[model samples]
Target: MPVVLLRLQEATGSGEGGFTPFSINTGLIFWTIVVFLVLLGLLWRFGWPAILKSVEDRERRIQQQLEEAERARVEAQRLLEEHRRMAATAKAEAQELIAKAKAVAEKERAALLAKAREEYDELLKRARKDIQEEREKAILALRREAVDLSIAAASKLLEAQLDTETNRRLVTEYLATLEQQR
Candidate 1:
């Protein structure tokens, strides 16, 4: 402002100058500087602090939100791990159950086979016993028939001369000789 005043004085001292076209106003410049300084001081004292506080609060809120998100991510990962472990355990248990079932089936099969073998052996034994009994009965019937036939033939040859006792003795002796030849 002082420099403007000095330039104005120099221009007025020049010879062909009426009120100069270009002139600086010192009072207006001084008053404009004063008003600008007053407004700057008011912003620094009040508005600056409010803006700073709002920015700090926003930053703190963002930090808290980030921490919460990290904790949630960790919890999700833990749950996934736990689920995998449980699935593996269940699979192992299912395999064990299958093995146990197979073992039981094998045991049952073996028991059934053993029982069938025992039944077969019993049936074979019964069949052999029945055959032996039938063979003995047939031999007895044949011997009786032979004896009767021999007695009748011998009586016919003797022509009623020989007695019963002598006929029987002769037949007995003939049977003994036949047995020795066989």
Candidate 2:
């Protein structure tokens, strides 16, 4: 152990002096080249393929997602257009409904006004007829009363002053005057 330790210390101390700059070193260079080749082959066989496949899968998935998003966007645009069309139709229909309502109301109003005017004219004509009939009946009643009063007055006058012969002559003469006047 002690000898080994002394040799390790001496070798460490003399390393700089024992070293050469370039020795051609065919064996070391060959081993280094073999290790680098093995590592490169391993990377190509496993690591590089896996990495590239993962990259491709990611690109494919992203493309699919972008396509889906585009489809969704188009669908949204279509829905927006449909909603606009429906709104336009509804607005037009509402306007037409309102116009129709106003027209119907005007028509009803005109019909009611015409009916009222007709009824008013009919009532006025009937009332005028009733007034004329009532006036004729009143005149006929007055005439009848005047005739009764004149008959009563003549009976009293003839009874007080005229004889039977004079009464008959007066009645005959009054009847003759009535016939001639008529």
Candidate 3:
């Protein structure tokens, strides 16, 4: 049989006029239109808004996540700057310490040099005083020897015996005559 004959048969209710096209099918057409309208309204009113709202909420969450990530990045940059400042401060402190140490060392060196100079000056002064004292002692010893030699010569020149009292008188008279000649 033809395919149209089978469709017309299914379209009609249980009856003997299934092969005819003029048979009543008003109720089938009406129910098909009513069910199609009901399905279209359900999709428009219920399904579409729920799907769209889900997409909008997902977009909002994604935006919030992006903002949080940006905040984290800015915070990390601030921490990095803080670390750099601390490192620079430490370096400056180290340099200052080194300068202070150098100054202290210089002071110590100057003090030691001054002490050495003072000790050398003291020793030199002592040496000069000792040399002067020795010179005076040497001159006194030479004078004593010259006096003894002069007395022996005078005794030899007398050529005659002399008493103690006469010797003393002669020495006194000679000394007085030498003074008058000068």
Candidate number of the best TM-score: 2
Candidate maximizing lDDT:
2
Ranking by lDDT: 2, 1, 3
TM-score to true structure, per model: 0.45, 0.58, 0.42
Q: lDDT score, residue 77, model 3?
A: 94
lDDT by residue (1-182, candidate 3, tens digit) is: 55766667676645675435645468878999999999989988998889999999999999999999999999999999999999999999999999999999999999999999998998898888888888888888888878888778877776454656788899899999999999
Q: What residue pairs clash in candidate 2, if any at all?
A: none
Worst 10 contiguous positions by lDDT, candidate 3: 15-24
Ranking by TM-score: 2, 1, 3
Local accuracy of candidate 2 as per-residue lDDT tens digits, 49-152 = 99999999999999999999999999999999999999999999999999999999999999999999999999999999999999999999999999999889
Query: Model 1, which residues run further than 4 Å from truth?
Result: 1-68, 143-159, 162-182
Worst 10 residues of 2 by lDDT: 16-25
Error of 3 at 25 (Å): 18
Off by over 4 Å in 3: 1-75, 137-161, 164-182
Error of model 2, residue 70, in angstroms:
1.8
Give the C-alpha miss distance for residue 156 in model 2, angstroms: 2.9
Instruction: Note the Cα lDDT for every prediction shown.
Output: 0.85, 0.88, 0.84
